[model samples]
Target chain A: MRCQQVRRAWLEPELSAKARRHMQACPACQREWELNRRLNEAFSGWEVERPLPAEWDRRLQQRIATARTGWRGWLESWRWRPHPQPLRLAAGALLLLLVAGAGLYVRPRWFSPRAVKPASTGIVRDLQALNQNQEILQCPLFAGHGAGDLANGAENMN
Target chain B: MVIEDRLTGRLKLSADVLDADAEQMLRFQAGDETAFEILVQRYRRPLSGYMDRMLQNSPVSDELTQEAFLRVYLSRRRYRPTARFSTWLYRIATRLALNYLRDHRHERRQLSLDQPSPVTERPPEAASPAPGQEGEMLADERCRRIRRSVAALPERQRTAVILHKYQEMDYRAIGETLQISVNATKSLLFRAYETLRRELRDLEEAR
Candidate 1:
């Protein structure tokens, strides 16, 4: 109810009933309220009166279109610089290098080279023999024919 | 339910205010240009109005308003919904406005240190509202005085007042935008109004 409370709570969206009741009884609070109203009115009116230029939206759109990011965005950012800021350019270059370095370090599997198994490494020879033996055991033709005959019959999957 | 609500481009303004700006921002981050356009459509006028109050409402303000949006666009990939989108936006705008003010103030000061500024008889930044009809002139004069008084305030107080009165931001939003506590923001507004009461006492007396 005090004048100080009214003054401080003036910015609150709604006034407390206690503050409102005291403001009605207090002359100084009335003036304070009136001043607040006028200030807000002046500010609000100022905004309403001074409209932005018609071409602002167009200019903004132009800026955005040209600034659509990527290689072109980078070029556009430094595009018209008759005299570019070297520090910024250097920082950008450094960033590019770091990104490239990280990309190289974390190359994905698809980007990685397929290993050449030397065609006859000992482990590969062993695995191939084991695979053939398993297929022979599973094949009914292996019961009545030699492995070479079965191979010809299978046509080596020509 | 992780409750979702329509944004309607209006601030939630509650303690647990849900921000559709975050949703739109996330969409924008994911390459939805339409969401970015929506944000621009929603904010353009309000932001321009905010810059007008802060930058004395001129062509520069309009330009700076676009610059703020542009920065938002460029930073879209980096966008995180840490705070309300509007809060993040006002913070961007306040910085731009304040920087422009400071840089221009410096330029003006440098001009003053020289012989009369070669730029113009009166710099555009210091230009008053235009001439008008008698009633309009009076209103313009009132607005001018109010602007001058507000402009004379320290940057924080002036910013707090504009955000509070013009933007209709609640204390918490204001505090978050300003990176200050709610209590600090409350006290700041209180002190700003006090300063306004003292400075514009003549206008009150005339009334």
Candidate 2:
């Protein structure tokens, strides 16, 4: 139990009197204490020694300045601008409604019967003409007829 | 009138001392440009060190640190005083570091053994005893082994250990940064420390 307490203390570092006494007496706990200390030292030793580049501030400032002047800056500035929250929300909702309404209004025009009728009629007329020619070609009277006879027959039908 | 002015100035000073980071963020959000410089000065070193340790490359660390700051700057309008400013900043840095690690995992695995460990660049300045040069060498080898063991830890455990031990974050803050629960953060640190203890036990025994 003392050994377990010592191990827990190694992690939490809130040692009680019993754990402290155990650590002092037990060679194993003493070793564990030393190991914990070394681990901490290793971590501290990894501290960054190199300074940031001298131009870092200047470059960052320049970038920020440029950003403020560009289109991104415009967008961000507009984004950050203070406005009443409820007003902004209402505006957003209104914009969404407008967009949805426009989409809905435009949708039927694209697929409306009036818009489709002309092209559909042209297709039907071509199909009818094709069917008439096919029927005429299959007719027994026109089966062995020459071009002149076929034209005469077509004229008569017209 | 003068007494009232003095009281206002004292109150401002007290607020600055008590919550300087969040105060500065508020100031910057309100279009006070110089407040940002104060924030940059404050966070630059710690954030850079955190990145350096996580990525194991000083140059990349420098770049990512700059990027993190820029992100803060760019998103200034989105800043809220809901959490500690340091916690938010760390969340950004941690995310950047984790993304970099994930993307470069394959490249990191192929690193040459000839390359030096990325933990520390300079050797300790202490002079070794002339007769104990061999002992000094062994100690150096042990330190190297310890570094490798730490670097070999799984990503979440490594992150937890770094945040808890190195950054000195409380479990709650670490959990917030990692987007985990506080209990999970504690569990992660426990597992990580256990792994470190096992890996470095030989060095302890040798001594």
lDDT of 1 by residue, A1-158 (tens): 67997888876778889988998899988987777777666666554345567888799889888777555466545543434478978987999999998988888854877776676789988999999888877787557677677679689678
Best by DockQ: 2
Query: What lDDT does the true structure give each of the candidates?
Result: 0.74, 0.75
Worst 10 residues of 1 chain B by lDDT: B114-123
Off by over 4 Å in 2: A1-9, A16-31, A69-94, A113-158, B1-18, B122-129, B132-139, B203-207
Give the alpha carbon lDDT tens digit for every residue of A1-158 in model 2.
56865685555547777777887789987876676676666665555566888888887787777777887676765584444477777887899999999999999988786534455578898999999988987889767887788689789999
What TM-scores do the predictions have?
Answer: 0.60, 0.71
Task: State in Å the error of residue A116, model 2.
Answer: 11
The residue pairs that clash in candidate 2, if any, are none
Model 1 lDDT, full chain set: 0.74
